[model samples]
Target: MPSRLRARDRVQGPCLGAPAYGSAVTTPRLVVEEELLRRNIDRVAVGARVAGVALRPHVKTHKCLEIARLQVAAGATGVTVATVGEAEVFVHAGFDDVLVAYPLWLDDDRATRLARLAGRARNAIGVDCTESAARARAMLPDVELMVEIDSGHHRTGCAPGDVGEVAAAGGVRGAFTFPGHSYSPDGGSGAAADEARALAEAGKALVAAGVEAPVLSGGSTPSLAHTDTGVVTELRPGVYVLGDAQQWELGSCSPDDIALTCHATVVSLAGGRVVVDAGSKVLGADRAAYSTGFGRLLDHPDARIVMLSEHHAVIEMAERPPLGTTLRLVPNHVCNAVNLADELWVGDQRWSVAARGRNG
Candidate 1:
């Protein structure tokens, strides 16, 4: 039925012949492949380079110091963090440039720590209100501040038109927006355009009020590809480095690009379902309406993850896999799933989660 193939085709599958009965066999554990990570990193870097924009990748997705170092080494100008503790960890790890992207309500201890940290690194803080600005100014007056504009995320940014007032109150040095609402499947180009317009207007407003808004930053992995460079000077995309089900659904990445996965072994099989060792505790419960299941089965893409528990993940397999077989599970949200593990096994090497429980 088919034509004769070359010698390369005959020497397919395993390069070597099948193993002997007595040969040693070892299973992979918690794998984070270096090749996958490099591919994803290069994809984002190329996209930003083509658009002539600076990429300050968000490190909140993967809180590993080794991964952060890899991101920086891969041409990332700096890193964006979500918490003071995160920033402190990276600073102590020797990352000189950091942006605390969250609008923090600084208390006495936090203010003192932030001030000290700002003095050490090229640091900047986010401000959404006058109270935050006053607190930051009182705590770290010399530290650069960015007015957080609400570019349709409606999370923690001020109104775009209120940029001047917010900047004036906090003595802000720049302006930035998250543009997180652009994650929706239908909200790609339109949302990015709106975010660009909002950031540009906010930057103009801040400059008009005598505040020097030099850093106009706005981006997320979903909007990173669609963003216009004319308005935003810097882009901060976190999940692009290690794609998740959300990124896959948004068409931001392919299945092969997913670098992180839960290496779980099937422990039981009953009721026409196979139960794995990993559950909500390891994989997390971050199902979206568009998502087909809780997580994806790496070996068997057709298998559906029907349910998840504290230490078990139930899969509705078409043809049940062996009970002892190990399956790789890619999470719906890589950030939360990563937070669950104390360490990650990259190939044969193990790396510690330096910032694992640093969610303050």
Candidate 2:
């Protein structure tokens, strides 16, 4: 069996009764448990530190400066972002080291902005093909580059054997992979192994092309526990900070570790179903092939989100808890859910989704 994250203490699950805010807070709001959030961050940070590996968490999951600051304070070397706009946000907030982990097709405006951000901090962008690599080198030579290798996700990244040419063309400082396949049911261990092998081969190819692969970056929330720290000089796992329904289903994180949840109210009980105000708009419609539902109720594991409309989520359950009941829901994918919200609530404290719509 593959190694797993350390077990966590179980809570009473998501808050069932009226939360501290009572009816003052609106329904379908994103709420986080600060203690659980810190616990999650500290656990991963300590693990990476003990293993002598650099922890550069991907900030794309949370997108809030406060949460990113927490990660940095917990000993993260830096952060990884999916877009240059996210990089711009963090770098401006004094995150000195940022990596735009996505392979960006830079136009004049994007190149100029990225170049400016690089001047303010240690920044790198991903590249897979020679054309984009050469373009990055020519357009923003001052910025560092990382060659993306297709470990298993096959979403974006060059083949392991093709890393050398791309690395050479971009003058890349290292190589990285996503291993997104780990999100599949029971795919963690295999995906982790693939990540290690792919990065290793990519590094060798880099050496063959007379390039020094100083940094080998890879990791995702699912494959993180099984990952070989020795294979990756830097680890970049995002969603770990805020456990979601997908993580819960994969057993990557326990229900007690879920820090963020959607505080939804039972709005309708008309059709012999439990319907809440949060739907695809708030929870996102990213149900994976292996996923069982649109989202999961933290307090009620047996109940599943059967249908999700724009402003309503239909919950199929044997017992309907009267209308106006407040429940905590775990979004299928926290990253997408966070992007849809303007702010996150932690008691009376509110955190702006600063990089919420920085998709560009």
Candidate 3:
């Protein structure tokens, strides 16, 4: 432990111990505790098994092959991604099965890329409309296709009834949806129900169209726990493996379930505030409408990141630590925060963010 910093909880270790995090890997570095991370993986894996739902967890959360390997070993049938680029990374890394869950706008170049990826691994692309579905088949003829349904997120995916039209366009394997609206005020269970209903109806619609809707997938972290198995066959909850402040606020995970935290150092202090050298550039500027702040101090749960510049986070703290003290902060959105960093520290060893910039 650092001679200067006193002992506290597990989160306070890097600060209290010598070879302090700041000295090893500058400030504002994303870190993953292996034990906690494995626990999270196990938590979700057990849940999926008990619920009798297939687990094909989204890998955009960690973006690390090491973490994805852990998830696969734990029981994830396959890994899910948001972009074609992400699928390429994992496929090259030997992930046999992958699903680009987002409805991608495939330009000619992206089509050729998906074609090559399909040859290397069992990859599937998403299409929410007939135009995209036709584009997917004509361009990347080798890959499987999943028609996206708008359970409640309304971000992408078509209406459940429209699934038949998209499937009729041909080459569709099944249906998928994201209940992102589950992030709202106490909306997990209800959104889960909504997702099941939408996907079930969508599946029947696809079958009615004679498109063989075998794979029915849907899930997000918050709504994952309440996700029932009937309409949704495969579940993909990314953030459950590395939770964030938003997940904590949604009661999706406890403080202990959070495995990813940023190691930031207190640079200065003012009346009623402590400034840390980690900000939106590293912590991400993803404070959801319902969130309390941009980030949360791990050691000081009550402290809120009141302000965030590109390189500084202004925290409101009751008892501030001295200057140069390292404090671990759990970001509001772990997925975005991880994307901001180059590598992650698992205690002393460094792990590369293999798919950091693989956002297509």
Q: Give the top-scoring candidate (lDDT).
A: 2
List clash counts for every candidate, in order: 0, 0, 3
Candidate 2 structure quality by residue, lDDT tens digits, 1-360: 222221221211234643544333458899999999999999999999998889999998999999999999999999999998998899999999998998888899999898788678988898888888999888887768898889989798989999877866745788999999998888999999999999998888888887764688999999999988878889999999999999999999999999999989888888788899999999999998878999999888898998999999999876788777778889999999999999999766999999989988
Candidate 1 residues lying further than 4 Å off, grouped into runs, are 1-29
lDDT of 1 by residue, 1-360 (tens): 233444333322221111111211233234687899988888788777878788899888888889988888878899999888888899998999999888888888777777778667898888888788877887777877887888887888888888888777655767888887877776667779988999888888888888763678989887877898988889998888888877887787788788887777667777667887888888888887778898887656677787888888888877666656667787888888887777787765788777777766
RMSD of 1: 7.4
Compare candidates 1 and 3 on TM-score and give the better one: 3
Minimum summed lDDT over a 10-residue window in model 2 is located at 3-12
Instruction: Give each model's whole-structure lDDT.
Output: 0.79, 0.88, 0.86
lDDT of 3 by residue, 1-360 (tens): 674433333344236332344344457788888999999999889988888888999999989999999999999999999998899899999999999998877898888888887777888889889999888788766667899999988788999989999887677889999999999878999999999999889888878989763688989998987886867889989999988999999998899788888888888876547888998999999988999998997767898999999999998877768776788898999999999988998976899999998877
The 10 consecutive residues of candidate 1 with the worst lDDT sum are 15-24
How would you order the candidates by lDDT, starting with the best? Answer: 2, 3, 1
lDDT winner between 1 and 3, please give it. 3
| Global local distance difference test of model 1 | 0.79
Candidate 1 TM-score over all chains jointly: 0.90
Ranking by TM-score: 2, 3, 1
